[model samples]
Target: MADEPKTPVPESPPAPAVAKKAAAAKPAATAAAAGNDAKLAGRTTTAAARRPKKAPADDDTSPLMGRRGWMGLAWGAFTAANAGCLAATGRFMFPNVLNEPPQQFTVGFPDDYGIGVDERFKDTQGVWIVRTESDYTHEAPGFYALFSICTHLGCTPNWLSAENKFKCPCHGSGFRPTGINFEGPAPRPLERTRIALAEDGQILVDKGQKFQEELGGWADQDSFLQT
Candidate 1:
């Protein structure tokens, strides 16, 4: 017995259509994920490229000096060496010379001296002006300039007024006031220098001309000044 008629049920979509839609959604999601991954990779590559590269720890480069600094040091050394060489050359070119006193000079007038040994010119002129009443070698009353140098070794002899002699301090050589060597190692009498009157009336002594008693040079007219 059919009591009532049953309601008709709605038909579901086809499995193929559902399957196609799901398949299309899956492909779109996969494509979106791939695009994001590609963007991230690109960003990472850009950042890495922008970063600076670091030098190796084993590098031999010096922090304090560069190539220019080394070159400057070499140039400075070269210049200093050249300067030293130039100085040596200059010293060789201009040799040293001795400065000696003039050979010819003039001492004062004859009236300024008295009889006996006058030591005024001993230290300065290297001569002793002796005014003798009678010279032993010349045998006359006049003035004679005796060289203060000893004949033995060229040492200077001092005049001792108390002893009335010229004594050589080096070897005990002795000479009378008349310039005659009497004791010690002296080979001859004290030599005399050229003595004359200048045009101005002042006595002029010339050390350039020497007179030796042994050689009869003391007999020369220039060796003695007759008062």
Candidate 2:
């Protein structure tokens, strides 16, 4: 009778209540994880919003902000200021004034001039003092001044010591020692400047007052001074 082999025992199945509890706990865990992820995303968004933004590289609000531009501007200002100062200094040093030579000027005493044509005043006064024979033979000799300007075109003539005459370079005009034009396109003789005796007995030459030889003004008493 060994009998009938004992029947093998069957394994017990899991309880439905336990399975339900585990499934519910799985849903709770998934919701908790989703909430944590949402919190992290919110923190990340807040941090990004709080961060400071970077500025642009080429912020050219003003020209002086750039290195090269600032240097150039500064240099230009400096140069302009220096130029203004230099101009001001020049104006101060040389003020606006009439610098023309006086029309009436004094030479030296009458005794200083000699009996011959004096070239001393040729460069400075543009005149030649010529002591010639008196028109009145009995009277003392008189002095006359001959201008060096050319009669034609009003050009200045140069005295040629070798030729004993005045030659104009502009038109090749020639003049004698007595200011008489001998050659070239000279219309007439060189004119004479007026001369007078000052209160101090000094010789005064008035360039404004002229004497024309054709007009016989040279024979006037004021034209010649008695030596």
Candidate 3:
């Protein structure tokens, strides 16, 4: 019984097959681990790149302040407005200061107001009415009326019956009773109002419509009055 040659048994082919399968499985596991690691790195990078944000603060943006500044603006506007009002008032009141007070009003009932020829009446800041008996020519026995003020400085004028003229006490300005400025600073004759006859048989005169120193065109109607 010599040691028969222990047969060198042939290695099983199944062993190599098993080893190849395990090697393939190892590669898959390694690839999966690498993929997981890459994903984790991406997340870390993204988080690190982000920056923190800031919050808004409340700020005061108001215009209320400084009482003195506002007061100055108000005062300036008020003064300008006051000046404008005064100027406007002057425009309306100027006539009163520069012109004579309407007086010596005439109510033209030539017969009632008619006196003698060249008959003069003192018209000192008053209204007068005249009526004539005869149909005097525009210049004759007809009655005339006028404001008794010195046309120059608005002084009340007095009529002198004997002289048949007007005299202003303020400045010696003189005028013929017929309303002519003969010697005076007056630029023209006394003012005259619009005169007319009322249906009631009385003469009507409008003192408010005092015409300029010139004889009104209607003043020529003195020939038509009946007292």
RMSD of each: 15.6, 13.5, 21.2
Between the candidate structures 2 and 3, which one is better when assessed by TM-score?
A: 2
Candidate 1 yields a Cα-based lDDT of: 0.88
The models' CA-based lDDT, in order, is 0.88, 0.79, 0.60
lDDT of 1 by residue, 1-227 (tens): 86798899999999999999999999899999999888787356766888999875543387888767888999999999999999999999986987877666677887787889999889988999989888776788888899999999999999999999999999999998878899999999999999888899887888999999899998899999887
Candidate 3 lDDT over 65-136, as tens digits, reads 456667788999999999999999889976655666553244434456536422244344264334344432
The regions of model 2 sitting more than 4 angstroms off are 1-42, 45-52, 56-96, 135-140, 161-163
Better of 1 and 3 by lDDT: 1
Q: Which candidate is the best by lDDT?
A: 1
Ranking by TM-score: 1, 2, 3
Q: What pairs collide in candidate 1?
A: none
TM-score: model 2 vs. ground truth: 0.57
**Which portions of model 1 miss their true places by more than 4 Å?**
1-70, 88-97
lDDT of candidate 2?
A: 0.79
